[model samples]
Target: MTLTLRQPSMLTGMDIPSATQPTPEPAIHVRGLEKSYKDLRVLRGVDLDVARGSIVALLGSNGAGKTTMVRILATLLRADAGTARVNSLDVATRAADVRASISLTGQFAAVDEILTGRENLVLIARLRHLKDPGGIADDLLARFSLTEAGGRRVGTYSGGMRRRLDIAMSLIGNPPVVFLDEPTTGLDPQARLEVWQAVRELAAGGTTVLLTTQYLDEAEQLADRIAILHEGRIVVDGTLGELRRLLPPATVEYVEKQPTLEDVFLTLVGAGTEQGQR
Candidate 1:
């Protein structure tokens, strides 16, 4: 929240030429990823590939390893075994380089309340060693629609505004990939839409984004691809249309009056038992 690079940033390394031949590799590549605490295994041989210029949403119920996966990708935690690459940079050994290419916004708006919105962005820009700190701050503020509130302390901001500032702070260095963990957790309906719009714009600009959330509707709205995680493992991964095809079509209630309980169940449960919440 203070934007101090709290520990040494795991994100520093070589910059490949833009004109270099593009590999078939994805922006994120995870193979046999495992994490254990004593005898309790939280992640078990998880594997995934996220393409560049896309948004991949991780969906799951409570107790799933979604947050754990996010932490590892963000370089906040180490896997007991397995490999992860961010922009082809290894998450463990090339941590600094990997971090450099990735930006992460955690579930909560972890802003420094004492700092002004402009100060928050400047802090991150400085921590990332970007030139022209003031200019960088100004640019992020304007881009996130926080320009008018730039000078105000984050503590004075509404939930939506604070989240915007928090996300803006993460982008000061213009990382190519971003990991957002349950970004809409605490926002009101309107604030959620604003964040969704921001996420869409980020992906539209060719930034690879990985988002983890419990909200199915959010995933359907924003993810170019969706992967369902359950009990620390990825259960399914594919495009929304693919999943929908595999799943029974959901029934709709188009109406003038309140639907009956049976109608609600039928609409929500769909025709197949396989179509589920997680």
Candidate 2:
């Protein structure tokens, strides 16, 4: 199948806001967030906000406090001095409520390798106390394109498939906010693209996502807003176009353009998929 990637025009089923209407509060809000390991400070008064139904990418290098920030926001870790709110509920004062509103996917797939893909999803659904776990599993399998391999052991699946299944399992109760902490860290190119598409679908379905990544291109491809964290603080935050404006405008040139490796890879992969279908 040919995959087309584009940002969603608006949130699913929401009408455009009228000019006179009050602005909606951000899905995530953080201010003066601070964390320390004895004398080693990890986060120093970092401030950030993520709009509802939008994807905000936290871009940082190794040891730049990206994971620290995510953990604080997800209610897995507490901040030393600051406030974080998810869906307008304070993550500190309402940790349980915050947990109920969000799902956290870590750097690695958290699937049970011995279990089949369907089994894993069903297990999560049952744990969440949802009705018809089998139906829930089937629906997510199809949603993430894992229907044919649903019966196969997760150990037999590829990296991308496992990650997709992990994400599908996280959507058991349709949590409005998702925290993806480097979800595509080690996947191959095609697998990375697969995860990217899955993330896009989340935003399209009105789920707010806060993605932490070291991949600059991943932010460009998926984030509605990009925030660069350096030395435990957000130094810059804006749309891709707005970030581009920070550099001097390009001079006019007549150099011939060439397709990037990504373009060539996707073209070949798409052609191969089409041939297989035929």
Candidate 3:
């Protein structure tokens, strides 16, 4: 149970250790969840399970329906067919219960521009009917390292700072399942790392996480199990090493000392594929 220090500059990604086997008692589960708009069926019989206290990553190509799935699970949208449950509460039928047990941080940060960091959290706490609104705000600021700048308006904060505050506010009620839909999408390198760190800490604190990201490295670093969605269905699901074993890590192989992977033709690769690991 010894702890070690991590060099900040070394890497900036959420690293959920790969699980040895499929987890049990998933915090969130979906069965044949399907969604459609007009003629386009975005989600087709999508099934996924995220175990309690573990981080599950959804890796997929563009238009693969990752975000749509997240929306359904978050109760932001209803499914055309099938069912989704958070902590065993149906997202469609028991939305109030489901929402109370889960928090969703969409791709964009949702902080109020007029409110300061502390005020933003305090506002959310009040809405959640939490006791000691002042204490909750202080704890969130301190936990997210915003105590120093918390007094400044959220609009004055940096992109990373605003994102941190948004995430902290999401936890005002300490929900068990948190869905982060591309949480680091628009962040710069450093800001992305900060969000990743917050996610790692959340998982370590025993919160079940279901995250969707276009960044494969992010999933590799933070996901206990990785699921690849293709054409609205799960094409592959396993640990990093398992998926790597399923297919060549990348299309181009090393020519001993060939050109860098940068210029290599990447026609279509999983968002998490890396070079030199084939």
Candidate 4:
């Protein structure tokens, strides 16, 4: 695919703080974060900061400790060194508080296939001890454009629809920070687009997002800033423009433009609505 690096619009409430105003603390912060299993060091003194109400993509190749970073931040795993915080709560010292303030969406969709979309949402809301679970379910269904499929079994829903439902469920308690570990790992182009839009909406609603993906285009299309993790540490961190500056300017050459596989496949099959007609 002919992937051009274009700037994505900043999410709402993600503007730089004025000089008159004190800068708000980043929603996610890490300093000297490290992890290891036996003799295999997974992370080595990694540091990063994700601004509130913004999307920060952590790019890395397979086994680059991307998932390990997310796990430590999400309070699912303990870090052997360094400090990390989510929403001003320490992931190590205050694991419970950090867990309450954030949600983690893994690579796979975590939905019950036997249940309908609405049922799955309601179940999560109740598990979080929220009131009006039914109402919350209805609201999320409409927000993710799943109202029509709300009553249908998730087993019958398309990949995109199931993923949307999983994300909606994660927002049950309105967590301030969200960790998406390769959210589009196995999805097709259409499903990836669906998740991208859902993530954009999350940022618009003032949620901080730390997205881990190996897809360069995904980071280019969605992140306010991109952090590249290499050899268990962040090798680079900056906006897309800043990262682009690291490389020399592209040479201008004229060549016949050809349709990318993505373009041709999408053109031939066409895009689908959120319903994703299972």
Best by TM-score: 4
List the global CA lDDT of all models: 0.80, 0.83, 0.78, 0.85
Segments of candidate 1 deviating more than 4 angstroms: 1-22, 249-278
What are the per-residue Cα lDDT tens digits for candidate 3 across 1-278?
11112211111213332354354446788889889988999888988878777898999877889989998898899899998878878899989878877888988898899988888988888887877878888877877778888888888887888888889887777777789988888876656777888898888766788999889999998999999888888878888889889875667656677664633433233333121121
Off by over 4 Å in 2: 1-21, 269-278
Candidates 1 and 4 compared by TM-score, better number: 4
- Per-residue lDDT of model 1, residues 177-248, tens digit only: 889989999886656777888788777666789999999999999999999988778889999999988977
lDDT of model number 1: 0.80
**Which model, 1 or 2, shows the larger TM-score?**
2
Error of 1 at 135 (Å): 1.1
Q: Quote the lDDT for 80 in model 1.
A: 96
Better model by lDDT: candidate 1 vs candidate 4? 4
In order of listing, the candidates' clash counts read 8, 0, 5, 0
Q: How would the candidate models be sorted by lDDT, starting from the highest?
A: 4, 2, 1, 3
lDDT value, candidate 4, whole model:
0.85
Q: Runs in model 3 with CA error above 4 Å?
A: 1-24, 248-278
| Candidate 1 all-Cα RMSD | 9.6
